[model samples]
Target: MADLAKEAASLHKAASGLRTVRQHTAKPLQEFESASHDLSALGALGSLLGAKGDIEEGMTTLVKLAKQLDEEWETEAKFMGDVSDAFDLLEVLLTAAARAEKG
Candidate 1:
């Protein structure tokens, strides 16, 4: 019974830590997504304006930057998903522990 309690406590703590990580990462992820959208719009605008030479090069750089941001966002999203999964698994473990203790 005591062992089950300890395990449940540990699982709960792990879930809480993962939630904190998710919270901290959420804002930066949102900001990256917003910036990527803005960059794409700027690139389209440059094309519509008939950019040439240096202007075209700048636009290209912007596109690259946007792509990089998108890639980073994807990586972060995957990390968040993994963290969420871990939290879910911990929750399940805690639930199981509780049931075991009760039974």
Candidate 2:
């Protein structure tokens, strides 16, 4: 019973740490999205200026790369959310264990 309590405490600590990390992760992702939007605006301006075909193509490639990066970050965010859900489940289990121990 004491061991279970220790394990629950450890898991709670880990879950809190993960929540902090996840919050920090969001800031950079938002910054990246903002930068991507700025780059897309630059790409549009370059098109309006009649940039050389090769230069336009390069800009397009960069935009695509930025989009890909955004997608990857979104996937990572989803994974983090899933991990958070798992933590919630662990917390629930811990609560049940404590209740059973009391009973």
Candidate 3:
């Protein structure tokens, strides 16, 4: 009967030790879960920054196209003005030639 009692006490001590080990193991797992959440949030932030960079690139492209169009129009306007002045000078020269032939 004494031996039976001793065995039961040993089993009780072993069970308590197991519970303590489980408690210690669970703390690290909880810390790992928290770190996992932080890493996931950082990944999402990185993706957002990449999207912002793409938008900036698109806007820069648009600005460059707009400036190119403005320069083309400015050059076209100057060319048209020069053509108009040349036509006017040619008409005046033709008039002078006609008057000189009359004499």
| Highest-scoring model, TM-score | 2
lDDT (Cα, 0-100) at 43 in candidate 2? 67
Per-candidate Cα lDDT values, in order, are 0.60, 0.60, 0.54
1 against 3, candidate with superior TM-score: 1
- Candidates, ranked, TM-score: 2, 1, 3
> What ranges in model 2 sit over 4 Å off?
1-51
Instruction: Candidate 1: give the clashing pairs.
Output: none
TM-score of 1: 0.49
Candidate 1 C-alpha lDDT tens digits along 3-101: 545655565555455446645665765676455444444566656776434554665576667557656655665565666566666767888898999
Taking the tens digit of each residue's C-alpha lDDT, what string does model 2 give over 24-53? 655765575456445545567666876545
The per-residue C-alpha lDDT of model 2 at residue 6 equals 61
List where candidate 3 sits over 4 angstroms from the true fold: 1-50
What shift in Å separates residue 95 of candidate 2 from its native position after superposition? 1.1
After superposition of all CA atoms, the RMSD between model 3 and the true structure is 43.6
The 10-residue segment with the lowest total lDDT in model 1: 33-42
RMSD of each candidate relative to the true structure: 9.4, 7.7, 43.6
